[model samples]
Target: MAGPNAPWHQKKNHPVRRHFPFVLLFALLGLSALASAPAAALEFELGAGPVDEIDGDGTWIATASWLTGQRHPWELAVGMIGARTQAQGVDTGDVYFVSVSRRLTWKRWFVQGGIAFTDSDNEVLSNHWQFRTGLGYDFGRFSLSVAHLSNANTGGRNRGETFALLQVAF
Candidate 1:
């Protein structure tokens, strides 16, 4: 049992939520940089995968990214993460995130690394700050990739989340 004064009881006062505006500002700025330019292609991805935890079923994710018109490596994306649940159990809170990632490709095989900021906090993803990395193959109008999201022990008790994704280009 925990006392009323404990940190867990104080959601509104959490450091990340207290500083949310600053985080959102930066994320928006990064995305703006990508959207400002005329995108060569826009990509949308949908995915689901198992959560790295006990009794975890799976998690779902969707994202939108603008691929730079030329072969530029930088991309900005905004996405939503669905909550995970145990077998016939309750669901955790959903997370909304924005990320700025750079993709390096070699003959349709590509890898991406980026930093992400999330707006919600919950058991599955305890921290508001996260790091994202993934690798996959681009099959012309679509792509197959797997992305991992980690809070990096920023809030402790981190198990990280990984998802296998399918992407469509428009």
Candidate 2:
């Protein structure tokens, strides 16, 4: 009899990765929809880069937006994130976070900024507070965005991110 491991093709179909940011985005969106939200939106992000010469890493993040008024292009947003990286045969860095943001729009361009509080899995990697700023363009129900996140305690490292945003109204 052949054991399950005997053949390379015998492996079952399974998901190998847990996408936390996407999960959080959907959860936040569902909550916003149920609350009869106006101009509420959710965004998800993934990132990867070199932490050092010997290693590379990735992270996932999500954010939700709420519009305060119908007339002005002012809105407030909340975000959450989960990130992890391994180096030198050890899981040496991680970040779990929550944040708040405000956005203002004019014609096709918009400017936004936010502040975040992060908890690190490894205390040595703790940066505590992170700040972000961005510029975006709106095209119908979709948009494109670019942002930067910086922290004083992060050893002069900054995270640059780009996002493709899509919105659907019910």
Candidate 3:
């Protein structure tokens, strides 16, 4: 007997269980087809992850934006973000950002670099400015990004941070 949500191994032992790779391949192809045929210009995303070294140790973030220039070389986005730590008594901040990036496409791979400004909401930690750049790849419907953020004031005590993001745009 197995629970409703049990893993396949716990539910049954069968030869069909070995066909996962083929199932995944077909699913990916279906998603790619859907992604390439788009009907809207606005996209929304929400994600949560752990942020190392912060008292809030675990960070949860959300983003919403309007994207234009569909699949073009030059792209622009305007959005707001709420990033907070999960630790007790830690200050969580919400900021607004506007970014512009150019897509460099090579085969199925692409790289994008962008600059953004954040309106710091936490007075103690806010210098009101941060810069970001990302490297990504487009697999029809999915894009993976590795990005970094640095404070504008080098003379100040603010430390820079980096984030690795994997995005699915549909």
Candidate 4:
């Protein structure tokens, strides 16, 4: 019978697995549109890096942020664009995370922290909530930084995801 037990069915197949790419595209487009608006001092950044595991093996990570620009040395941003990982023959599935963060800047250097709400509880993100933090240096339209995400021991496997990201600001 062509049912759940069929050869074409896989145990790891999430109901939404086939729609991930489309989801990613719409996210990117939405962020880009926000950045394209004529609002003054609006800022947008796109970043990618590696997702590290305790075993020293890692996965690729991508992220993006949209903020209200620099004002009074502090700003608020919506940081999102989820990530996925495959470890030990286990697919962590898609991670849908969104956070409202406070970005503080001093001269060309900046530090940010925020609380994130996530949709997946997997190897990398084992909780319904996560904390996001980053430190970086801005160079005109570009920046370099490291981003760290953790569950603060609220769930299983507190192993955090930390990576170096090169950001393009527009």
Candidate 5:
């Protein structure tokens, strides 16, 4: 059996394991923020795009997002993304993220940006700090947005990803 000097005990594998607790804490906080929002403040979005140009050798991408009711310029959102990509021998992967966005609107056009904590299953992508930005044109209850997600080179690989989305508010 390997002891303290074992390869498994090295810092590389331990990074994600060590950070698991922090991720859990952040998730909890995000949930609480969502809970605090009014029921009528929920928004849903669906997005799709090409994958390889963003992060991997995938052909297509799909994402779904839910944003909690807005408190002026601030809102909390949770998003799930799935990509059909061949990266690190995996044919598919998913990324789940929580973000706080600041939105500014003038008439029917809006711009939003925020930082996020991403948990990804693809070996080529990192499972931590990410940034997201997007702009959309709101048509009452419906909108179209173009957004991008990236680790900002915080990880070993940071190709980033982009999406074109259609959103609806209930």
Candidate 6:
């Protein structure tokens, strides 16, 4: 006699399902903020490199960021990043994250720090808080950065990761 309305069918049974609404709300707010921004105020950056691993098996990394606007020395951005590698006997181990960053710049040079919420398919890692920091050079339309990412020891296993990336903004 169970149907779609059955208690077992309810989203509360699943942990992530229970939080879906909140995640959706946060995403909507972020999108609305971006939509209200000036048409020419968006800056985009894309970069890729390798992630260092404790076992000497590196992962391929890539990231994209959108800089919305600036306030004095601080620039605000939202970013998505991913890394992939092999673990065990399977081609596994991947991590993805969404983050917000604040950058302080001095003419052609800049430093940034950000917090990220992360998800990983790797059994050795868990969904956790991630911190990122980097320094880069801005050459007008193009830039280069060397960044580090870690769980700040908040997670039981935090080996950390690093990447050198190139960026372009319009």
Q: Give the top-scoring candidate (lDDT).
A: 1
Worst 10 residues of 3 by lDDT: 44-53
TM-scores of the models, in the given order? 0.75, 0.48, 0.53, 0.66, 0.66, 0.70
lDDT of 5 by residue, 35-89 (tens): 7767677666665555444333545455555667563345566666675554555
Candidate 3, lDDT over the whole model: 0.49
| Ordering by TM-score | 1, 6, 5, 4, 3, 2
Please give the RMSD to the true structure for each candidate, in Å.
5.3, 10.5, 16.1, 6.7, 5.6, 5.4
Q: lDDT tens digits, residues 111-131, model 1? A: 999888876666666677888
* Residue 104's lDDT in candidate 2: 76
Worst 10 residues of 6 by lDDT: 72-81
Question: Residue 117's C-alpha lDDT in candidate 1?
Answer: 80
Itemize residue pairs with steric clashes in candidate 4: none
Name the runs in model 3 displaced over 4 angstroms.
1-56, 65-72, 79-81, 85-90, 121-126, 152-155
Pull out the clashing pairs in model 1.
Answer: none
Tens-place lDDT per residue, model 2, 1-170, is 44655542343321111333543564465455434534353333332222222245444445555444332333334444343445444343334445455567788777877665454324223344566666877674555666655563555433333333333212
lDDT of 2 at 138: 63
lDDT of each: 0.71, 0.46, 0.49, 0.62, 0.65, 0.61
After TM-score superposition, what is the CA distance of residue 154 in candidate 2 from its true location, in Å? 8.5
In model 5, which range of ten residues has the least summed lDDT? 51-60
lDDT by residue (1-170, candidate 6, tens digit) is: 54556663364443235545654564565455556667577667776765555455566676666666664232333443444444443233456666656678888788998765554423334444567788988888888889877776776766567777777765
TM-score of 6: 0.70
Q: By descending lDDT, how would the candidates be arranged? A: 1, 5, 4, 6, 3, 2
Which predicted model would earn the best TM-score? 1
Ten-residue stretch with the least lDDT total in model 1: 45-54
Count of backbone collisions in candidate 1: 0
lDDT tens per residue, model 3, 1-170:
87867775575642224444544453354334335545364444332322334654444333433334346454444444445555555554555554455557777676666555454525223444455565766665556656555565543545444555555554
